[model samples]
Target chain A: MDWKRYLFIALIIIALFSVVIFVGKTQTPPLVIAMSMLATTLMVATPLTLGALSGVFCETSAVINIGIEGMMLAAAFFGWLAAIYMNTIFGYEPMPSLITGVVVAVLTGGIFGLLLAVLSITFKVDQIIGGTVVNMLAIGITGFLNRQLFFEKNSVFGGQVPHAPGTLPIIHLPVPKVVGGVCSLFTADGCPTFANALGKVFDQRPIAILAIVLVFVSHYVIFHTRWGLRTRAVGEHPRAADTVGINVTRVRYINVVIGGLLAGLGGAYFTLESVPSFEPLMTNGRGFIALAAMIFGNWTPIGSWAAALVFGAAQAMQINLQFFRDLIPPAWSFLQQSYIVGLTPYLLTMLILTGIVGKTVPPAADGQPYEK
Target chain B: MSENKRSFQDALSESPLVVPILAIFTSMVLGGIIIAWAGGNPVAAYIGLYQGAFGSLNALSETAVWATPYILAGLAVAFAFKGGLFNIGAEGQLALGAVAAAWVGYALPDLLGAELPRYLHLTLALGAGTLAGLIWGAIPGWLKAHTGGHEVINTIMMNYIALNMTSFLLNGVMKDPSPTNVIARTPLIAETARLGTLFAKYRVHWGFIMALVAAAIVWWLLERTTFGFEIRTVGANPDAAQYAGINVKRIITWTMAISGLLAGLAGAVEVTGLNYRHELGFSVGYGFDAIAIALLGKTHPLGVVLAALLFAAMRNGGTRMQFMTQIPVDIISVIQALILLFVAADAIIRYIYRLKASEDKLVLTRGWGG
Candidate 1:
């Protein structure tokens, strides 16, 4: 049944790719276009993949974290701010400053995660409302500080929006040699075009690659470790886990903080990796979309990654459509509208949620606060 | 007389409003601290806030104007709370309502090739918006009832879809055709379809009165009606309500529809009474703010109105506060979030104030499986 679902998703992705190729009207070969689209999909999916992983960790430990958006937003802002300060105030070089920014962003996310833990676990606030509070606080604090630090005339930076430190360097994988070696049996020229296209697909930034690595690492940690067993036990039945000498509160706290760290990394992807600058509400509901992906993936690490990929492909299609606006047929002129194209990911989320594919079952005690 | 006075003190201490008021006060204090930390005088900021919100007739009028939508949207969320459902889709429903109202406001008369009477045109436009919101809100309710889809995620998805759809329409077909205009907005509404102001010099319109009336009606519907009783029963314990032969599914759907209707009316009023055209970025975050208002109001109709007014005052005063103290208007959102936190988690307030637990506990919603 799971394989069938995966196959269905694969078919959809292929169909979406075919549409992009058909409407692209470029002289580039379909294979090269498809390769680039896959690359774009992976790049676009980086933040979502991290965010979904964040959800997976918290929810697996029975802490509902709707505050992932807030966490990401705060991380993005503080991370960017730290980078700027490091460059201007401390005279640190770009590479070290960016690394410091990433660290601060992760810590900021962890701090918020701890705050959420205190509110929901220690104070026993409703988890949903607690998450909402985090979100609102993030928005208010970020917006307020963004203005005072950069936009205001009496700001710390004297009203100048400092130049972005720089984006993370891409990890250049040696894909062309691998592709050329594989293609040597079929062609005399060793498939230079195929090598080049495949090479570009492998050229992604460190965080994007880290996101892919973390998916597997998280899957291993959640499914194959003693800690994973304890976490699941606490989530399903805290009293039972407690009777077995497992500290439920400790497990939940650790998992939630780990989730925050993941979300913080996702935030860093926005400022440090992708754009090198921060924008208000720039997470732009990706955290919510990541939550959807987590649920759609049935809260499994690999499943969520797969779901994130589909969403990423949808966004990639939208991005690709913008370049090929002139190529859209007269009858299908509506496809040229960026707003219409942007609806695909959200509409797809809704459709999946309607139980057409399959019902998603959350953990039994997913949102309940544990008591002694 | 001495015993009566003691009892009065006890009653005042026990009143539900105590926690909310204290929460607001604490949040304000914290906000002042934030302002001071940001190198602004907290006293001047608060003074400016008070003056901007209520210093003059014009200020009061602006507060009323802002409160109009907050009141309606707050009611939308509060009404859903009575039915054991969370209608986060109010934002989307409100947007669709505005779109529907704007379409009717600008296109209807032209389509009919005649001018409609002022009263009829206004009513039709408002009705169109309400119906659109009702439909938008009902879909998530129906999905939750029939298919076990969670409203939280669905509502968020619907928001994106509706927002994108709105952007598409505003950028394309619904765009103002005037040669000078390039913004993603509709043309001005017909004069007949417009809501009239209470005073020529003030922006306060009939919508403010309608919001007050709507609050009273919501109170009546919730307290003095059988359907309201059913909603409360379902909200308290769905299994018990089901055992009593209530159609839980229908109630949920209707609750969402009504909630959406109120949200839509908020948008409609904005279009017909104030903005006179539906534009992108207008009424942004009003729906989300309504959530905090609903929570702060303790999910009561009258409480919602009061909370809306408070929120409206803060929003209206924010500009003046910024002007006087150089504090960012965004501080209001932080304060509102704090208030919501204290209200939702009343244990903190109770602990701080050393108050005993009240009998009426707010059971917002159950976990995912529930």
Candidate 2:
């Protein structure tokens, strides 16, 4: 199974890199284009990676959480709002204000997670319906407040939208040094072009790097910890877990809240990291796509991240096609239509779900409320 | 006489409509508080909303026009619920249906090189739209039946794929191509394909009546037919249905196709009976909103019609409410969400009102892999 997963990942990576190189050779160096596309893919995949992790945490606890979209949306708005108030009203520095926004976003997601727990666990509502409620409520509340706070003529700030504090700074990596060391084995003069291309690939914003780091951390935490064992026990057979004194409810609550925090960080990536402003439905259905990735990955943190990368590559292809439109070959004129390129990820999701690898099985007691 | 009066009272209290009515009332009250908090007079805003929805003949006509699509889309969702399937792809299906209708309306005459009779042309356009929607919906259903793929995820995947396909078609071959037109839309449909208006001054047309007739037909199909019985049996308990000699897989696929057909009809009517051409961004969110409508209506055909009208009124009234009080029309969505919340989680309402829980509980679909 592990070998199969690795092979699938390798095949997809090779295919995507080949396409990038082919497209790039027409205008620039193939390696440089391939490296840049890889970087873009990782950047685009960050939110999806985080969102899939969120799904993994909640579903592994047997509390189906389809409200990842709503949680991320609320966090994005509140985080952006917090940053604006910190800079404008409190007169804080840009760095500190942005940090404050991230914190607020995490807390907003946690609060909503708690709301979901109460509705599903305490009130005994259908989990799917509960998720729908959170989504609709988030859309309504955010849309209403966005208009009232920024757009209304007689509202706060006198109808002028406040200037965004600014996006997070990119963390420059020591990629050139690393690449130069590797290049010295083959060439007397280290390949500056190769090093520079690799450098661009490694240089990323803080949250983007954090998403990668979190994947390995979540993998270790979920598979090699006492808490993880309890989570699995409760999700699989709650009565047995309760009989064994595992405190099923407490484990579920903690896991679901953790999921919310991850989704919140994903939300922050939208407004605080990528763009410094908010837009209606800014997440743009990425949360649902994350769920698809989660299922495709069989609900593992590492596996889900790999699936997210595949989706990211598909999206990056769409973006790259737009940029390199003139370089497209005459025989491949259909690729010039960006919408056709946009269909890749969704079509891929369908194919994968239809048992391309094998049937994916969820946890035994998933979506069932424990009466005890 | 005394016994009959007491029974009537009991019936009113115990009716399935009780929860929906209370949910609507509670949502409006909460909506008012939100409006007041946002700095507008709640009373004035609500009064304006009322006037805009039903105060004049024009307002009523507008409400009916909006209700037509809501009714069809709502039925699409409700019908799927009856078959234990969640058809979230209605939005995409509806979009494709509109595209198909528009294509047939504007392109068929040229392809045939002759003008068709009005009735034949109109039927062909509408039929094309319905068939497109049916195919779009059936793919996911077939996959769900054959492959253990969850319909929820597959339907969502279908939505993105369909939307992108529509965008490609509209931007390329289907572009209106007028010198001044820069938008992605179809050319104006042939005059022969258009539906007649009910009145000279109002936008309300024969499509509204068609929606009502469709509802009645759906009711008959669900209640009085052997196929309906099979669908209901499979929905309630697939194992039992299989034991009783019903082909559960086929029923599941057909149910989704029928649901998609209704949703597609909604889009076709909008193109032929309302908008003369299909355009991007013309009918967004109706499919999503239909989910709330289905829940509010308790998944009943008659109840769906009422819920559709209620939603239509709120949406129609939002503009007037905004004009009068500067309140954003998004409040209607908030209220709709609240209503859905209360309906889905009736325990809160029961707790507040001190009522006993009812026996009939909604099951929706089973979780993934069930």
Best by lDDT: 1
Instruction: Name model 2 segments beyond 4 Å from true.
Output: A90-92, B1-13
lDDT, model 2, position A356: 76
Q: For residues B325-361, what per-residue lDDT tens digits would candidate 1 score against the true structure?
A: 8888988888888888888888888788777666666
Q: Residues A72-139, candidate 2: write the lDDT tens digits.
A: 99899999999987889656468988999999998888887887787777776778778878888888
The CAPRI-style docking tier of model 1 reads: medium
Q: How does residue B100 of candidate 1 score in lDDT?
A: 95
lDDT of 1 at B365: 74
Each model's lDDT comes to 0.89, 0.88
Native contacts recovered, each model:
0.74, 0.73
